[model samples]
Each structure stands twice: as C-alpha cells, then as structure tokens.
Target chain A: MKFLAEYRDPELAKQYLQEIKNTVTQPWSIMEVCGGQTHSLVKNGIIDMLPKEVTMIHGPGCPVCVTPLHLIDKAIHLALQENVILCSFGDMLRVPGSSKNLLEAKAEGGDVRILYSPLEAVQIAEANPSKEVVFFAVGFETTAPANALSVINAYRKGLKNYSILASHVLVPPAIECVMEDVDSHIDGFLAAGHVCTIMGNFEYYPLVEKYKVPIVVTGFEPLDVLQGILMVVRQLEAHKAEVENQYARIVKEEGNLEAQKMIFEVFEITDRLWRGMEIIPMSGYQVKEKYADFDATKKFKIEIEEAEENPECIAGEIMKGIKKPIECPEFGKKCKPTNPLGAPMVSSEGACAAYFHYSGLVEEY
Target chain B: MASKTKPVKMQLQCPMPKLDFDVITLGHGSGGVLTNKLLDSGVFDLLSNEVLDERHDGAFIEMNGKLAFSTDSFLVSPIFFPGGNIGELAVNGTVNDLAMCGAIPKYLSLSFIIEEGLKMTEFWEILTSIKFACEKAGVQVVTGDTKVVEKGKGDKIFINTSGIGTIHPKANINKNNIKIGDKIIVSGNIASHGMAIMSVREGLEFDSEIISDTTNLNTTIINLIEQFGANIHLLTDPTRGGVATVLKEIAMATEIGIDIFQKYLPIETQVDSACELLGLDPLYVANEGLFISFVEASIADDYLKYLQSDANGANAKLIGSVVNEHPKQVIMESAIGGKRVVSMLPGEQLPRIC
Candidate 1:
C-alpha cells in the first residue's frame, strides 16, 4: 500500500492540480502516450479538474488498437484452421479481423486458446508434438521481452511445433511519426513510464530537441500523471523543451538491459500497419530472420494480406489525435464496441475504446 | 476479412494432465476447462447452501420490509490501477450490489486489512478515494476499522465493505420474470474496466489506452426503472465477472435458456484486442462500469429508447433474449453460422483483476 497508496492522495492530487493551474498561461495540448494513464485521467475526472488552457488528448499507446486487421484475421484463420492451436492473451479474441475475430472463430469450433503468457504456449508445444502451436504475439515494448524470451526458449529446446506471429510495435517511432506530420496537434508528450522501465527514457531526449516540446516519462499512477503534466506544462510555459522523469523509483534512464536484449534477439524493426493510422517506417517489429523458423507466419507459410482500414471507422484519425471516435457518423450506430468498425475501438490502447468505455455522458465532452 | 494462409498446426496435445496434483496450481485457478472441474468437485461442495449456493459474488439477504445487505472483498493486484484505487473500488463495489437488487444504496461500512509500515501518504489517498467514491454514489461511510499485518504477510491492502439500501416496492424485479422472446440489452461497451486493469497491472500496452469503467450505476438503474418500471425483468452489474457470467446466472434464475447474438454484444475495440492478447474470454473477464438488462419484448422498444436517451445508456445495444429451455444454460448465437454454449467463468481468468 505504501508504494501505491500515496499516488492516490486527494490532497496531493489537489496540490498538483493547483500547481498545474497556476503554471499554465496559454493553451497547450499534452498527449499521454500510455493508454492506462489516459484511463486514469478520464476516470478520476482529472481532465475536468485541470485548467481549460491545458488540453490532454489520448495518444496511440494502445497496442491492441493499433494492430492491423490482417493480423487479427491471421489469428482467427490460425485458430480456425484444422490441426492448428492458436494461443494469445485475452484481449485479442474480441478484436474484429477483416471477416471474423478469434472469439467468433472460437465459437465456431476453432482451436483458439487463451494463455496467461507467451511462455505457456511454448509449454503447450513441448507437451504436444503432433500439432503446430502458434502464439500470436502482441503488444508494445513492455510485453515484447516476454514474447521474445518465449521464442528464445522455444529455440533453445528446438521445439519444432512452436512459433509466433509477431506483432510488436515501438513507441519512439510512433512519437516521431506524429511530430513529423504537418497537421499534427500534439504539442508535448506524457511518455509511458512502464514501457520506459523496460526500454529506457533516453529515446525521448532526441525527440524533445527535434520537436521542441516537453517529454515527461512517468508512471501510470494519478500522482505520477499529474506531476508529469505539471513538469510538461512548466516546460511549455517557459518556452523550453526538456525530458523529465517522475517515475524515478522504478524507471531508470537506461532501462532494463536484459529485456532489451531478449527483444532484439527475437524481433527486428519493420513496416507494419496500425489500425487507425497509416504504416510508419520502422514502427513495428517482425520476428528476426534468424528466428524465422519459429515465426508462425513463416513456419506455416501463411499468406498475410494487408486490408484497408474500415471505411466507417475514423480510428486512425482518432489515434492520430486529428479526430474523435464520436466524429465518425457511425460511431454509436454502425460502429460500436460490439461491432467495432476499426482497430482503435477494438484495441485496449485505442483512443476510441477509452472514450467508449470510460467517458461519461457524451454530451458534456 | 482477409485470411492468413499459413502452415497452421494442431495445438500440442495437453500432455494428458494428471487427475491429481499436490495442491491447487495457478492453472487450476484459470478460467479454462480445469477451473470448471475444481468448481464442480471442491469449491462448491464446501460453500453450497440453500441460499449461499447461488454461486454469486455476493449473497443477497433481504431484510424484510426495507434493508438489503451485501458484502464484498477487494483482491486486485497492484492495489492501484489507472482509474480508481482500492478504496474507491471497495465503496462502489458494495454500492453497486445494492443497486442490482432494486435497492437505493445509501450507507456503507469500510474495513481495511493493511500491511504494516504502509505509507501514511498512500493510506490518506485511499481514504480520499473512499471519500470521493462516497460522494459520487451519494452514499455515506458511517464508520470503519483498520488492521495492519507484518510485511510480506499481505498484498499491501485488502478492503472489505458491507452496504445497505432501501428497495423500491413498486419496482419488483427478478430474473425469474424473464420469458421467451424477452429482449436483452447491454448498458454500454464491455471489457474496458477489466482489460484496463489487466494491461496496467501486466505492463501490456495497446495502440489505445484502457481506463477502468469504475462508476456508481444506482442513478442509471433508477433512470431505467423509472422509465421501464416492472418491464425490467432482470438487472445485473457484471463486475469481477463479465457479461457471460451474469447471463448464466440469469439463465439459472429464470429456469430458461438465453441466446445472445455475438454481433450485438457491445465491447470496445481495444478491450476486445486486450482480451485476445491475454488469452482471456472477454465474456468471462471482469467489468466495473457495465450492466445488462432483460425486459419483456413488448416493452423492449420503450426501454431501448429510454436507455439511449440517457448518457450512460448511449452505447446501449439490443443484444438478445431469453428462450424456452432449462434455465441452467446460456447459448449465444455466433457471428458465424453456429451456436455455442456460454457458461460461468468457473475460475478467475486474471487473478486480482477486479
């Protein structure tokens, strides 16, 4: 409780909110790059408590939301295919592929199974020698290491039946892509502290200098978020760009070397599609060439086709901070959480899902 | 949707799991096939009773003419998540239970089992969260007690909250009232609060963000009851367990089967993806800020309109309804051309995910 209780202190939250209120002199938009932080901001009514001049928009930190339709389609296809055992965490099952989702396939007698970790899939493969078992690896840097380590263990044991359809994404490339866009609205960033705990905070220093905006790497706690916001706002108010870290207790400047190594060994940066946004350079990671034999897409010789974003979904625009999920005419109509039109609504990190699940009356916002 | 043409392989055989193990493993606690077995053989045997055997998260004790009593314990890892903390969770969880039973949750008693040396700051924050939670739900924490344990003896803090409320007499509601052709409606998207809790706790990131759908729904329920009145056959807040669990409960309560259209099942894109990645069934995952209502088909339209007219029910969808069959089962029509049995979660998919 000591580690966590302090972060929720109302007096502390009020003190930080007051300081943030006093610091902001002009209108500024600061994007919290982690979906978890976004949830806290909305659920705690933090945004409403803040000064009107400081606008906080959600960012593309949701890994599931950014995953492409084809990847989902591939997972369902793998799950439904005879003799194939598809494995993934709970989140991917409801994500709509082009035609169906893992949940749908599961309903139709597909061999789709939920796992607590990628390593569990390896154990399943080890236990069964006859069937090909594929772990549909998903998420950002925080989970990449675990997925990577699973691959390493599979290779170490020479498990022929084990492989992964890697769909890992990076945060820095995404930030850069946003800043490079000419019509961008992101003025600063609340860097994901958990991701940085594994991948380090140094990456943002370069972005701060390049974009001339504040970048605060902070934990997901409310106090952490509020403090991070205050730091970023002060930087913006002073017309100065800097990189700050409020999650110093857990997040070091260098990050976890062991995790980075595992990730590097298993995956290599490559082109990949994001649900709501266009494909950016080196934003996603593919299974390393050396580990291709353990790659589900490769081992199965599966042909993956990139499908266009759902025409009805403005998820990409929403993810880019250019549009809101409600902006789409079909938001609550044709496109809903039950029948999501795009990835943003499906992925946990998506802005639209955040709005749909946690937002209060659509009218006040 | 494009399909992936790959060298799909069969799932490795389950290694013919042993029928006997020394003690319960985490796998047994998982909401898979094995977990169901444990419930059938072990857990239910000890706890089963005429009333307590209902297998609900919290038991409902009707206090004759006025009061409704319910108690719940908090056991979420990382005690603090994206939205509300344990203190907030403790208050709303008990309050929501009273609301579910057609009662206006009005007062709460808080008890805390804390680890020793717990930071004063953190404890203060928890109290603040409870204070705000009370304010939001329009409930009062009349009194409370706190106890501390040695370090490593506890998971930071565990909250036990008991609440009481007054039920509305004119608005009698029960799942048994559901009949064939009754319409099923969800208050909003599912899995947001559940997935958000998992992602933040597990350090999993998505293309979007996840926030806990933690809120007081007494007002929303009251709104529906006012508009639809007795037409609301059943009302349940699917927390700790998702929609699937509640549906199964209703099926048993009504002695009739249920069939929900998968397409009409409301959930966010990210929550869906998060469920998939975690190898969890969103139907079985926990939800903090969502509900499902079963109403007579004749009044379904009016209720639907009333739900949409309100902000909380803005994303409400007409999912499915009751069928003529034994009430012990739940059946969902797949988006694909097939029907599948949707049952109770049996075990916890994500431990301490509440």
Candidate 2:
C-alpha cells in the first residue's frame, strides 16, 4: 500500500502534469528508453496527462523484447542438446523465439529451468556436479550486478560446470543508437530510472550533448513519468539539452558504486545485436575472455546463423519510435502477442505489445 | 490524496523449516503440488459433495434439466485496486463460473467471513461495491450469512459466494464434446487481475498503474450461447491457475489434448510488466474477468466474431484447439513454433493471487 498510494498521489501527479504542460513549446517527440517506463506511460494515461504537442514514444528498453530470436534458439538448442540444464527467469520462459522458447525446450526433454536469480544456477551447478548448468543472463545494467555476482560466485566456488549465455544489453550505447537512428528523428529521452539507479546518470551526458537531446532519469511511478516528461520538454523548449534526474529519491547521480564495481569485474564491453536494430559498438556485456570458460555458447561451440527480423516486419521503424506497432502492416494481422512475428510483440514491455494489449483497435486521436 | 493503508507482510519472515510452516502458505494454496496434497489428505475429503467431489471450481448436474453450480471465496489482500475491489470480485467471480457452463446465472448466495476490528468506512465502501456489482451483473445475492472472527485470526474480510443457474436447453457445452477440431478461444488478455494485485503487493515502482479487469463475463457467455448453441463444446474461466491450468483441466477431463498457440494469446502491457518484476508467468497468474470457449472448428470463426462484437471480447483470440491425438496433455505452440507440454502446476507459483 505504501507503494501504491505514493504513485497514485493524485495531487502529486497533477502537480507534475502542470509542470510538464508549462514546458512544451511546439510539437516535439520524446522517447523513454526503458520498456518499464513505456508501460507506466500507457497504463497511467500519462500520455493523456501530457501536453498534446509533446508525443512520448516507446524505446527499445525491453531486454526480453530486444533479445534476438537466434539467441533464444541457441538457448533452446543448449537445453535440448542433452545433459544440460537451461535456467532463466519466468519472463524469458514464455517469450516466443524463432521456433521455440525455454518452455517448449523443457517440454522436449530439454533440461530447461526457471530460477529466481543467477545464484540459483550456481546452486544447481553445485548440486548437480555431473551435469552442466547454464544461465541465460538477459538484462540491462539494473540486473547486471546480480548476474555478475552469480558468475563471480561460481568462479569463487570453482564450479567448473556453471556457465552463462549472457545477452546483457547496455543503456548508453542504446541511447546512442537512438541518436544515430538514420531516420528515427527522436528529439529526447526519459531515461529508465532503475538502470540509472545502478549504473548512474553520468553515462547519459555525452548523448545529451552529442545528440542535443534532453535526457531525464525518471522513476517508474506515474508522477515520476509526468515530472520527467516536463523536464525533457523544458530542456527542449529552451534548446538547453542536458541530463537531469527527477527520481532522486532512489536514483543518485553517481549510482551504486559497489554494483558498478561488481559488474565491471566480470563483464567486458562488446558489440551486440538488438533484434531489429543494428549491432552497436560496445553496447552489450560479455563474460570477459578470462571468464570465457564459464560461457555457454563457447562451451557448446554453437555456430548458428545470426537471426534476421521478419522481412515483413517494420519493427526497426517501430523500435526507433518513428512508428507505432499498429503502424506496421504486420502488427495485428501477421504479427501479435499470440504469434509475435517480432521481439516487440514477445517482450512484456515491447511497444508492439503495449499498443496491442491496451488498445487493440488502435487509438484515433 | 494519497493515504497509507496498513502494510501487509507478504513474504514470510526468514525461511521457515523447508518441510514445516505454522499456517498454510502461498505454496499450499497455489494450485500446485501442495494444493493437490492438501486436497488429497483431508480438505477435499471433508468438504466435497457428490457434485463438488468433481474437484473443480465448478460442477454440472442434470437436475430437472441441466444445472451448473460454483462457489469461490475472495481473499484479495489489498481488497481494492484501480478498477474494482474484492466486493466486485466476489460478484463477478461467481457469475463468470455460472456463465462458463453456458448457464444463464440468476441467483447467488453471499457469505462474508469478516475479521473483527475492521474499519467501518472500509466495510461501507465494500458493501456499496457489492450492491453496484450485483446490479451490473444482473444477478441478485438472494441469500447471505455473516461471521466474525478475532482480529488477527482472519485476513480482513473474506467473502464467499455460490452461484446457480439453468443451462440453456439447446446448449450442450461439456468437455465430452471437446474434439480434435474444436478451437480454444480466450475472452481477453490473461493475468490482468493477478498483476493488478501483485503491482500493489510488491513495492516495485513502474511509471504506470495496474487496474483490475474484475468484471462479470455473463454477457459474453450469454452472447456465445445465443449464437453458437451446441457448437459450444465447453467454457470455463481460468481464474487462479491462469490459462495454463485451465487448458490442462479441460484436457484431462475430456481425455484429449489441447494446443495453445503462444503467439495468439492476449496479455496486457502493465500485467506483463508487473509479472516481469515479480518473476511470475502471466499465463500461470489469476484473472477474475476472462473465460475460455471451446467451440467446434466450423463455428469457431463465428464464435470469435461473436466474442469480438462485445467490449469484453474485443481482444479475444483463437489460440489452439482440442485434439484427440495427444491425450490428456496441454501443449502450447511457442511463438517460435516449438511445442511444450503445459502440465498442471507442480506447485503453487504464487499465493493469494486471486
């Protein structure tokens, strides 16, 4: 109730909405990079609460939604490859890949499992020494620290059987991707609050200056989102692009140093493929070459082809916030939650999924 | 204005003895292994009637004609959410069960298990909600009872409601009619009610609000019965066990197999987001406002259309269908086109989700 009551502070939400309204000039589009933020914007009618000229578009903030279909297949392939236990969070189990997810792999006699944390993978590795245990590590910086801890724990314990199929995407590179969107035309960003809470707000300054887009680190609360939008609009109206924090109650400018230290200890910056977006430089985390023995893909020697988005899908444009899920011809017809033709439909916070679930027929205004 | 409600400590303090617990835990009532064990040992043995012995949330009997009966107790922790409350939940839950049998639900018996020392204002708001919900559902709480317990002995107000309705004479909806060609149709997205509760239960922050889709589905049931008649093979609302268990039950009961297309299932953004935060599977979560229709393939299109015509069924989708090949198994066709057997829950995934 403490959680619910605070966000529902009608008075606070109204105050934020008032501030946001005072900031917008002419028409402008701001994209919130985190799927969690996108969900909040749609669920609370935050968009409706905002100034009409200020359009908030969803960004590629969802890890599950952004995970490439081939990676899912690779995880499934490992699970089914005999004598392997594939572990992942519950969210990744139901996500549809090119042909199967972990759930299906489990059904096909694959040793697929759902674990609460990467530490559980270590536990399973310790408990079952004869068998190999692999965790499908997928998340942004917010989850990286805990996942990094798991690998470090496994290493400390000297558990040779434990490894990870890391699909960790980075926030800073993703923002840069938005900035470099050849045709995306994104003007600003409401940065995901939780990620900043762990990784800090410092990384976003370069993007703010390089792309000339206002970046505001905002919490997931309704009031937080409204206040964040207001901050971005104010920066845009004054042509003063900069990084600000509206969720300071939890997110600090420097973030959790301990978490950053732990994450850096285990992971190295690497190029990663986002499902519909191009592979960005140093946009992902991979187990450092020294920790390569704990990597699943390397352990299994998988040589699968890099996956391609369904050619019929306009998800690339959708992911850029230049278009909505419904804007794609394939969205409801050939692509949807039931049979997601792309990552956006599969991830819980994917823009396509949000648009499909809340307003199935599409919003007119 | 934002006001603090009493905090509910959901996570039990420090892990108790793995095999031992003081009170029934979430796992015990989770509809998983513990639930099965709880039922096998004595709970079901003591409370079951010949009809109730069917061991389902619902039952059908051939009284004079055909009759469907169901009872559910609402123990929602928060009691109130964005769209509705436990009072509305109780009414809608009962009505939906009766409608699941293609029954024109007419009467309900309400029973309240109240915890003493509860606030009068909360009681007033809840009762008013009951009146509003009953009126909207077009059903009356014809009989009722009230019981009070010691303050800490109970969890606020627990409500139990039983419903009775006459099945349409022309309607022959039953698992027996579930054939290979029958299609599986869901009324709306899965997990709205479950996530609506979880969003509040866990102190997770999101830039959004989750509203309960806690409404009666009698109208949708009524429309389906009117349009499809005998083509309607079966109908049931996947409440506590989510869509996964619902399909498994139908598969086991009918001695057939069911395939749910993962790509075709419905899920809301907020519900999905909340589920992600809590490590919950939306399919395994609960819902008070959804129903699954098992209609013959020939009429599946029409039934989907009929469902689509209604506001509640606007997000309705034709998932998988019934099949005699894989007997007693519920398999979901993953979005990637892989198939997995969706077995009945091994244990409760979440407690008090309803």
* Number of the top lDDT candidate: 2
What is the DockQ (computed on Cα atoms) for candidate 2?
0.04
What residue runs in model 1 are displaced by over 4 Å at the alpha carbon? A362-365, B1-354
lDDT value, candidate 2, whole model: 0.74
* TM-score attained by model 2: 0.59
For model 2, how does the per-residue alpha-carbon lDDT over B1-354 read when each residue is reduced to its tens digit?
011233432222122222322234345434588646534543333223455455445454444567888998999877766677788899899998888888888677777777765554455456667766777788766555556676566777899999888888767877777778888899898898777766554223234466778898887778778778898888888998888888877777778877777668888766766675574667889887888888889888888987898999999999888776777777665432334456544344522100
Expressed as tens digits, the lDDT of each residue in A1-365 for candidate 2 is 34544665767777766677776669998999888887666644566557789888888888887777788888988888777888786567767766776777877778776555788678878988988899989988888998899989999999999999999998889888777767787778899899999988999888877888889998886777777888888888898899999889999899999999999999998999887877888999998888888988788888777655668877777877879877788766777666678767755577876666444242110
* Candidate 2, backbone clash total: 12
Cα deviation in Å at residue B283, candidate 1? 14
Error of 1 at A28 (Å): 0.4
lDDT (Cα, tens digit) per residue for candidate 1, span A1-365 = 34554676767888888899998888999888877787567545576678899988788888778777788888887888888888877667777888888878987878776666788788778877888889988888888999999999999999889999888888998888778877668888999998999989988888988889889898776788889999999989898888888889999889999999999988888987776687888888899889988988877756767666667777666666776666778765666566788766654455665565444222111
Error of 2 at A326 (Å): 1.8
